[model samples]
Target: MVAQLETPILSSPCRVPYTVEGLLQVFTGSHRSFFTNVMAQALRIAGQGTPVLVVQFLKGGIGQGHEHPVRLGQNLDWIRCDLPRCIDTPQLDEAETKSLRDLWDYTKEVVKAGSYDLVVLDELSLAIKFGVISETEVLELLEQRPRHLDIILTGPEMPKAILDEADQITQIRRSHRP
Candidate 1:
């Protein structure tokens, strides 16, 4: 959902900003058994020669995750939003609530700046699901973001709007073995 603004005529020809191709990758599952692998692959492939940012909600780092210990590259940037560990049970005091909003604002700034080539919104679905941030707000930010910016959103219970807007969607479902 890209918003097109009216181009202002300049006395001299205005320098047109370089339009970069962007893609959104969505990953959802109750059990992210392959979250790290998918994330690592994304980083390994797209993260080269450009900056990558990971905004983690609930868990801080790869090591902090409950699953396998995932190793991150040196150049990757990490921003952890302190949300309740479980979406089913959210415990947020006034301070944490403020912090979550602050983080959301900060993420908007980063995305708007178009500084990073790739950005991963880890567990962002949970944040939206739990009302930490509104889906409409996020959608607006995404719409206004630079074309060159590529984004990846991870977590369970992704909204239909998000899924609809995503270029690619991966659902990692855990099967019940007989």
Candidate 2:
């Protein structure tokens, strides 16, 4: 099931100041289930003129597998890393790896510039483990991120380094059992 935020997260008194420093939130577990839950949370935090960038790291592309681009308020920008959107093979080819690198570079630049109040690296942890990007590179970028920018990383098997730095770590278990 998709997890839903109880209410507008930013409007709460306990909300962290978006510009004070960078924060990392990691969400892990069932892909479809947790992705739904994380997006719900992002939507809640995106109000009040906060800019949000969503980088979809993995998605289906062909026949019966198209994913709707995620968007909330006008401040939200969504980019899908897998285009034509097919699933990756067990191993990525040279071209695929380069594409992933380019995406990572773009994400890094966006975070470094502090362009968005919130940046969601959807399925990024899985991408890192798949060798699409390096965990070291991600950690370095996180280290340099603008103090005020809040980031959300989602995907199963989150790396220990990311977990160490995350302000919140949520594991969304699947509700349905086979």
Candidate 3:
């Protein structure tokens, strides 16, 4: 379900002079949950010609890698691990581990280069929790990103350091269905 905006944003394909210098936001929730609104927001920004990068750390099974990126509206780039299957557990083969590391490295390099105005790191917490990437490195990346870049991180049970660094936090909860 989508949150009702006080005012609807009509996309007439115009450039928006973004006001904020940068923002760090976190969306934490249960495992296997879909962050539809986050994705929607990213698309909306990208549709307006703002650069958006969506990195899915744990999702794979699709054989996606840094070499191949799915571009949307010429402003959004989506990348996933180059693994044979979606990583759901900590146990990974040597090859699977290497692929994840590659994606992480690529993500950092591009982000440090200020390639995108908005970056959505999906399941990044899990990558840290699984020890594929260190939390300290993630914090350093967040700290070192371009000043005007807005970053959104989504996952379950985000590390305290990441949460503390967030400018805003949105926790999703499932309501009881009748």
Candidate 4:
């Protein structure tokens, strides 16, 4: 039944909105479901024009290891930012801290280059929770983001400041099944 429903969405052409509000409207429900739909739409739109940079937030390999499911009519340059390989917990070793800094620097450089159409920062809330990435750094990135660039930051517990600045914000709550 699920496969049957997804077939049509997967087969349909990509049609993503230009505005952040429109994009938010497209994914108004649960995080997993919203992300799946958003990625599909982003991939479809990306195929039509320039490449996209997808920065996936890593949190125990949620949503299939940062790789977008390859469905028909999907096209986009997906770049996954898994963060420092080490230091799974909130407390990080010296090396892990350095690596985290390196990751942020690399991301800044990429955004400055203005090459990608979209950049998905996945599991950013975890970074904040663990003190891996500072809110200041995120704010700086948002302020410096290039025009026409689409940035998607996912995960639970998003900062109030970031949410305020976001053009679109979607909250995914847990659902209990019998």
What are the Cα lDDT values of the candidates? 0.70, 0.72, 0.87, 0.58
Ranking by TM-score: 3, 2, 1, 4
Q: After aligning candidate 3 to the native by TM-score, how far in Å is the CA of 97 from where it should be?
A: 0.9
TM-score against native, each model: 0.75, 0.76, 0.87, 0.64
**Candidate 4 versus the native: TM-score?**
0.64
The lowest-lDDT stretch of 10 consecutive residues in candidate 1 is 61-70
Better structure of 2 and 3 per TM-score: 3
- Return the top candidate by TM-score: 3
Model 4 global lDDT (CA atoms, 0 to 1):
0.58
lDDT of 3 by residue, 1-178 (tens): 1221233345755744444568899999875465788899999988877889999988888888988989987999999999888999999999989999999999999989998889999998889989999999999999999877889999998999999999999888889989
**Cα RMSD of predicted structure 1:** 7.0
Off by over 4 Å in 4: 1-35, 59-75, 81-88, 175-178
Candidate 2 whole-model C-alpha lDDT, 0 to 1? 0.72
lDDT of candidate 2 over 91-170, digit per residue (tens): 77775566567667888888899888788898888788788888999899889988777888988788988899889888
Candidate 2, TM-score vs. the true structure? 0.76
The model with the greatest lDDT is 3
Report the C-alpha displacement of residue 79, candidate 4, in angstroms: 3.6
Extract clashing residue pairs from model 4.
55-120, 57-122
Assess the local accuracy of residue 118 in candidate 1 as a C-alpha lDDT between 0 and 100: 77
Write one digit per residue (lDDT tens) for candidate 4, span 58-130: 4323232233422333446554334335234687667556555665677778777876656666666667778
